[model samples]
Target: MASSRGGSGAVGRANELEKMSIEQLKALKEQADMEVNLLQDSLSNIRTATSRLENATTALNDLSLCPQGLLLQTLSLSVWVPRKSKKL
Candidate 1:
């Protein structure tokens, strides 16, 4: 019957494991801090890259209008010619 009623000692042993070592806690905190710093650095780099891309997109849009400007210049080349042989 000892094997059928021996779960209380296991529970008491589990309660003893509730207190963690200071070194383990410190290591966990340091790892969390490092992750936070790395994420902040990544976010900063992303902001920088996004700002540069926005500037490049704006420059591309401004340069794309060049062809339209040339089209306006070409409109002056159309000249009306009168035909002398018109039967009207």
Candidate 2:
């Protein structure tokens, strides 16, 4: 059940809208449309970021499963790390 406190219920909103002038209604509609657009754009960006993260994770998993020598060759590395400098 919906609460009617603070004039937040649908019936309360309808009564409020009924008291609003035409210009006020127009402005409210414009503001609502802008908010909807912003929300949709945010959703799209989140989905794209999620997809890119998934692809990167899958690629990392594939790389980890590759043969050790192949992995080293692909990285073109002769050693995992250079020997510590004797002077240090």
lDDT of 1 by residue, 1-88 (tens): 6754577777775665456587867887799999999999999999999998987787567557654423222223232222334356
Best by lDDT: 2
**lDDT of candidate 2 over 1-88, digit per residue (tens):** 2454654677788999999999999999999999999999999999999998987788678668865645232323222322333454
Instruction: Give the TM-scores of the predictions, in the order they appear.
Output: 0.54, 0.69
Instruction: Report the Cα lDDT for residue 24, model 2.
Output: 100
Give RMSD to native, each candidate.
16.8, 8.0
Identify the runs in model 2 with alpha carbons over 4 angstroms from their true place. 1-8, 69-88
* Superposed model 1: Cα runs more than 4 Å off: 1-18, 67-88
The superposed Cα distance between candidate 2 and the true structure at residue 32, in angstroms, equals 0.5
> How accurate locally, in lDDT, is each candidate?
0.66, 0.74
The Cα error of candidate 1 at residue 12, in Å, is 17
